[model samples]
Target: MSDFMEKLRHLIKGGEGCIDHMYLDTVAKVTVGVGNMLPNVAAAQALPFLLRDSGSSASPSEIAQDFESVTEQEPAKVASRYKQYTQLYLPEGAIDDLLDRRIEGFERRLRDDFPDYDGYPESVRLALMDMVFNLGNRGLITKFPSLTRAVRENDWAECAAQCRRRGIADSRNEEVRNLFLMALG
Candidate 1:
């Protein structure tokens, strides 16, 4: 992975760490591994079976095995698993591959979705990806229209201001906005 992607992955991992067994997220969905959401687990593999479902039982060994396998799997499969499950349990194992694929995919999508994307600074690109990773593309696109416009115009100050106006804590907003400025310079 590129240096930029590595940095983004570290930031994402800061927010979404690895968990081996199945657990419930804020909305009560089954979550396992690193941020993998359970309902969509099938998309990860040819035999994408849930170690534990919302209403199913899973032994400790079974859960351990599921988590271990994720770590043991190849990079592509690991990324595929994460995308399908939303959480990938083994950070030590497949994180690099997962980050590479996820970041590259996001960059490609950004370029495709925005005509002005190619001219944006690398930091802006990274910030945009971070937003999508945290808030989803729809949230970035819909929740922060001014931020989107500012990004399109390469108006880093306005982008930072828009980021600061978010409902998230000031510290986090400041951190992200600072990242934008760092990229701008």
Candidate 2:
């Protein structure tokens, strides 16, 4: 991975803790492996989930059972608590792969929206990627028109002012703001 990707991976993992087991996110979505949401049973089944005890590959039925087990539990519990609902886990390497795939997919969407994405300074790129990671492509694009306009116009200070997200920690917001500010220097 490039240095930027390595740094981004660390940043995202820190923000979204890596959980091998499926759990309900704050919004009750079935999520695993650094905030990866499995929207349906088929999405969960498509991954290579392993038996937590034996580390053997899980059968489809076992995966489905585990998925259902997790879904039945109360929503918004701690991620570790959800482990009790299933005997399945995603291996660490698989988690990394999933994160990589998500980053690549988001990058594609970002490039589509910002044709100059690749040419931006490292700090600008990092801030934008982190924003895209937190807010989906459409969310960032549609919700934050001022921030997108600032970015397209290379107005780093404006970007910093407009990038704050709801429900995110203030520290994370500051970090993104600082990244944009860094681009100013």
Provide the overall lDDT of each model, using Cα atoms, as 2-decimal numbers.
0.59, 0.92
Deviation (Å) of 10 in candidate 2? 0.9
Misplaced by over 4 Å in model 2 are none
Flag regions of model 1 displaced more than 4 Å. 40-91, 164-170
User: On residues 34-102, what C-alpha lDDT tens digit does candidate 1 reach at each position?
Assistant: 465545434333222343334234444544445444444444232334344323233344435545666
Candidate 2 structure quality by residue, lDDT tens digits, 28-134:
99999999999999999999999989999999999999999999999998999999898999999999999999999999999999999999889888888888998
Residue pairs with backbone atoms closer than 3 Å in model 2 (clashes): none
State residue 57's C-alpha deviation in candidate 2, in Å.
1.3
Top candidate, metric lDDT? 2
Clashes of each: 9, 0
TM-score, every prediction: 0.66, 0.94
Q: How close is candidate 2 to the true structure, as a TM-score?
A: 0.94
Supply the global lDDT for candidate 2.
0.92
For model 2 the local lDDT of residue 60 reads 93
Q: What is the C-alpha RMSD of each candidate to the true structure, in Å?
A: 9.1, 1.2
